[model samples]
Target: MSVISEEHVRGGSVFKDISADDDDWQPTEIESLCMNCYKNGTTRLLLTKIPFFKEIILSSFSCANCGWTNTEIQSAGRIQEQGVCYTLKVKTKEDLNREVVKADSATTRIPELDFEIPAFTQKGSLSTIEGLLDRAVAGLEQDQVVRRATHPEVAVKIEEFIQKLRKLKEVENEFTLVIEDPSGNSFVENPVAPQKDEALTVAFFKRTVQQDIQLGIKADDDLDEEPAGNDLETMRNEVLTFNTNCPECNAPASTNMKLVQIPHFKEVIIMATNCDSCGHRTNEVKSGGATEALGTKITLHITDPSDMTRDLLKSETCAVIIPELEFELGMAALGGKFTTLEGLLKDIKDLTVSKNPFICGDSSTADRIQKLREFGEKIDKIIVGELDVHVILDDPAGNSYLQNVYAPEPDPEMTVEKYARSFQQNEELGLNDMKTENYEEKNNVPAVPGGTE
Candidate 1:
């Protein structure tokens, strides 16, 4: 991350490139108000699905009255679980020409120049490093006339800075371009991606509470200005509704959360959201209690169709494996899920086949697609009890659970084991850095690696 000092502003950027387009898709043409001409214009909207990436909406507007035109791209994917930061070393002319996607929720910086572009100050753009610099230069030059007249002293400083910025376009020196996106939507292109572009580095980190508020994931202020305000505090069962923006459409919506206890299990938080704008509904289950002393591993031998109805809770830290099918899903792969055995299997199928957006545009191979489809078919067979398989759920937090059909009788086909978490697992969970013994005994807190004290 670059040290923030001075920030620049730029207008929206537009890119006309498409990695790949769905062969069978059609675009929608509609009449809309034009921002430039203030007259109705023709807006063409196409929802494009990338081979191995989430879908995006490509829209182009043209006004007959003023010959005004504009093009923009909007991601149609869900909000990623973790935010991402991309740092690119613009050491050569090729690096400057690489494509970049700057989400509106991202912050951009030129570390060498000590210049930053705060999030939301500029619109989202699908452009390159050189284009980004060009846009910045244009925005600064736009206000020079007024600045030179009203504030000549400050204007002189800006003029000198502008000249310095233009010199950067010559690639006479190397600089780092950093983009920190709390929304995890920004991108810096690597021409030979998957092969490791030495000039670029990418990292994902947890979003801050302030970032969550800005993204409309949570209410910035107490939303309870009504009689039911005290319900969430006083009543555990009462669903607490809070205003939030829809993750799908970024429109006003509400998220409802409730604490519910599972029989023979601990209480868990269930959150559900319904977006009226796009009619998209999403629900996630999260453990409500503190971390357990040890981790948990549960294995279930599925041989009957009735097993499909068994309830399952896969914690966020759980890794799922099916030895019979030679399948493995790493931790946080499916997130925290509360669903039935059949539902989980279906989700696995959908994710591994239909929704695995990592095809990398044109690099997707036919064999890979066939294999994914075959995996989905195998999962369907498992749901129908056509194949017997052992499903293992390993959770480092000991927060996962599987409903045993036999319950107190101890389902003969199910086995549960408790074991201490490994050091690497503890480090990943930040438990290694936590001082649970005597936190009050410390003076000025020291920062831990990858975390604050």
Candidate 2:
């Protein structure tokens, strides 16, 4: 018989030390990307007003497992891409280091070797691999045109202006150019020709001129106009104003709940409600108005029982909530029905319960057993649906390594009898089966002293 303390009933117990016994599973340096290159691996960012690329990494991968796809957009619309307005390929160590020095770099960097981007572009239309790569490079180059054009009318109008960039890499891995003077003299300087073996097509274009001729093109006097126009200004301002936290207290209680908004589900809503120290409930609404934007907040009270139940069943972790009885139950191994905090305290009363009674690892099972043991003392023949056991790992010093094992959910594909036996063995053996299946004999972890449950 033992007792768990109230302070031990936190989720961090499961979250903090996520132990993967194998050393090979740990992250490696090759898996990490250079933050200075590729804008810390962020290829694109769509803000509340303007949508554009950042001039950092020429390209980076997004997760296909997370359903990220790249598609051409007809309009950036009201929502703008925040932070940097353009992205350039990391052409050299100097270019990479420049991005790293920018300070406010994006955090989406992936390990260079382990990264994969979403591949749903119309790449099939490309007749050759060169054409596909050229299209990607050209599209990226076009964004730079949209970034530095002088004329007010030239915003986002790439077809009229010729893009000229000095190919900075031998294999075209990434590119860079050093601006020689402030009067745009570097734009006129003729870059050294690529080596015969290089696969690079390095040329600078000015308006319609295709190659880097002498410092010949007349410098446009119209460079005096502001960088962004009224429409672009309004868009950038809106993008700058986007709140990534709660408006009232700046708390990060908001979550992106409405994940998808495809054709059939045109509008997705995300809401957050806070009852803060101010004593008033603040509700934030997003996508509930106008078109469904990427980072907006909304509030809606969920009333469906099945939705609540599904949320409860999402994990096997136990959540117990009985302020007075927390210490006793938390220390005891417990399980079943008590997947949530409020759900576990329904039966507690003023009854003189045993303070040191062993609670099973799973709280639901422990509560059920406690109730049954109390009632069966006066009745008979109570059929429990499942059982749980406390699998204690012990150090050589005789201290227990507290652990939990639970009966599995009923499976229709597996016969009830087979399921029962499997579930029973899991409760009895704890992690023995897992160790046998996943661990090799040559690399097995040393056993803890207490053995299986």
Candidate 3:
């Protein structure tokens, strides 16, 4: 991936008046830089709740050097001052209207803030509260206790305890507390104790208020009603059964058979169907053989554009093009030589003056190739001071034969059998397989033993 540059910030303002970007909207480098500048070091801005297009940015910046923290609330937009300063309530209609216009429509709704603990409030022991609540609920069965709590007076006490738990959940520091009754008697046996402030165990406490308890009370008040019976599976099955039909023949389709899904294409295929009367076996989906949705088997041809020897053979020379020339070079890492200069030259000369060539060689192969190119009196490959030559072989009908070959690797992670198969399919062509009445004499090859059958 490329590094993000500064241009992103300049264009971000265009989107400022628009709705807030998605949370997953990965910021460009310049946009990140703009956000950093907006922070101004003193306060951090957390993107929390947003109203429509406006984002609720929570800024809390802490200085490590001085152990100081500063927090600010900003309406997320283009980070402009006017867009961020509309939190104060307006006193008059005109003021409200003016403030409304300044408020960012894209601002996300802020989540409800929980109760805050007052700094001057008497400190309470978290462990003490937990122990007290645990002791209070210990003897009672959770289901039965919650059922009893449905009474007005009991519910009020539980709600009060719940509120205390909520406040306890908000405390950030660890501290111990000692409680004393109004009679001046200490509550705890030991005065001093070690404790860590923890989030109020509200979920555990909520379980104390059980569903059975609520259900019993709901029953007592004649408010309980039987839940609707669920037959979702049967309904879904009926819906699926309704849709199960062949478009072409209106036959019942089998759900047991799995269908092949080709990408970017639509058509439910039913394979191997037999028509009783017509005795015709057919596939359900149309044979969209060359559809764009169906992946194509691409054939590539890599060639030097400058080669003209093949064109000369087709136009003027009597020699017919022998398109297939097979030259098998053993695998590289087996300490086997890929190609020899004489072998390469012999293969090129043996061609019917029309086939393109595949030239593979060592780093200093140009000198060797130039000598081979001289033997045929043909302009074959451009010696670009490279060891390899990948040429496109094509018939006069523009049927390309040769595809691409990657640069030779020290240890190509392919089996020799696979390499051999690829060679037979892609690179090699049979040039000697061609026939002419007097071609044998011109090429100086011996006559066949069985004569011209």
Candidate 4:
């Protein structure tokens, strides 16, 4: 199921001297101003490729005047097709010698201590485990001089933390170090090389919206919302589009939208995405109208196999219930969708099993994963109409619908009901604060200082 291709693994040797040029084995040099001392300094930049890894730039800046220096690494290759995470167990003092290639966008964490090095807090580095900890120590100590002068208590605690961090290098106890790089450009050394290292595990994941933006994979404003409250007559023919990251790979993609009408229902916007980068196709539906004055609850009895074909509109605000399975899904768990009964069941199953983040990958979470698989099996029974169940649709927005196969005739097994929403439901739907006919007089609202008319 993982779409990422494995990069070449290096072993036996520590590293292939990634900063060395093909012929000169030296970085290109340039003189530059040193920010530390405002003195002339030398900056060396290298363009080299790591065997089995992508091309990258390694830079070293040094100022003789203040003895200030900095080193960093940057990717010259395109972003990886997937995000990558590395987890390594440090059980012995020798484990501290493991080499690490950390990208600037990578986040490092030690769950044992509940400590983290957030992404972009420091420069990327090609260093060993021991060196990484040394950097962490240096970073912690950097601000202590100033902190001690202004605030002693906070500085004292930081000193304690720094001491604890230094002890990690000693490896007195077993611990795990995690590095998550959304760019998929980071690496942790595998001592066994071609052979797998038992202490290190790598995982690939889809990047989140924020991660995509931070990596320049997608613009921050690309995922635009459709204009609100547009009447069908005005925009139904227009196919609006906005950029979005592919849910499968985080590559840039476009989502196209148009107003669509379902029989006997109000207009809704249907958006479809076909990601060229990953060949991932998807669709979403959103109700185009405003919330109703009353909320609706629809109950349908699954009595026959034919019920599988019943069309259902699950609004974003809808909650699903299955009495037979004793399952109740909260709102926003599944996004707004318009699909058949069978499709809805599959979506629910996928949400619980395949797409669940906690789906088993390790021994610690196998029990939870099994329970989710069992839940999916129950859904399968319901989909095949093998189980007697009542499906309930509760939408406080009153925008959800289930097809009445009986048409004009009342469906003997289905019941439709509407009721006044509770105070909490109104608040959740923002109806409690909605002001439609408020003459500024009712609330005595204040006007802006530079108001017009």
- Winner by lDDT: 4
Worst 10 residues of 2 by lDDT: 188-197
Q: What is the C-alpha RMSD of each candidate to the true structure, in Å?
A: 11.4, 30.4, 33.3, 12.6
The TM-score-based order of candidates, best leading, equals 1, 4, 2, 3
Point out the worst 10-residue segment of candidate 4 by lDDT. 1-10
Model 2 misplaced regions, further than 4 Å: 1-453
State which candidate has the highest TM-score: 1
lDDT of 2 by residue, 1-453 (tens): 122223333411211112346332221111223333422221332211110111111122343244343423221111111111122334443332221111111111113222212222322120122232344456546456546556445554433322222222232554322211111111110111110112221121112221111112335342335655446334323322223433333334433233222232222233334433223233222222231112111111222222122112101112122122112221111221212211222222211132211222212245545654454332111112121111111111111111111124432221111112234323322322444443544487766568667
State each candidate's clash count. 3, 48, 20, 0
Off by over 4 Å in 4: 1-234, 237-245, 437-439, 442-453
For model 1, the superposed segments whose C-alpha errors exceed 4 Å read 1-81, 84-181, 186-205, 209-233, 358-363, 444-453
Task: TM-score for candidate 4, please give it.
Answer: 0.53
lDDT of 2 at 209: 22
Give the TM-score of each candidate. 0.59, 0.16, 0.13, 0.53
lDDT of 3 by residue, 354-434 (tens): 221212211114643454345344323322212233322222211111111332432122111111222332222222243
lDDT score of model 4? 0.78
User: For model 4, how does the per-residue alpha-carbon lDDT over 301-325 read when each residue is reduced to its tens digit?
Assistant: 9999899999889997888888766
* lDDT-best of 1 and 4: 4
lDDT (C-alpha, whole model) for all candidates:
0.77, 0.25, 0.28, 0.78
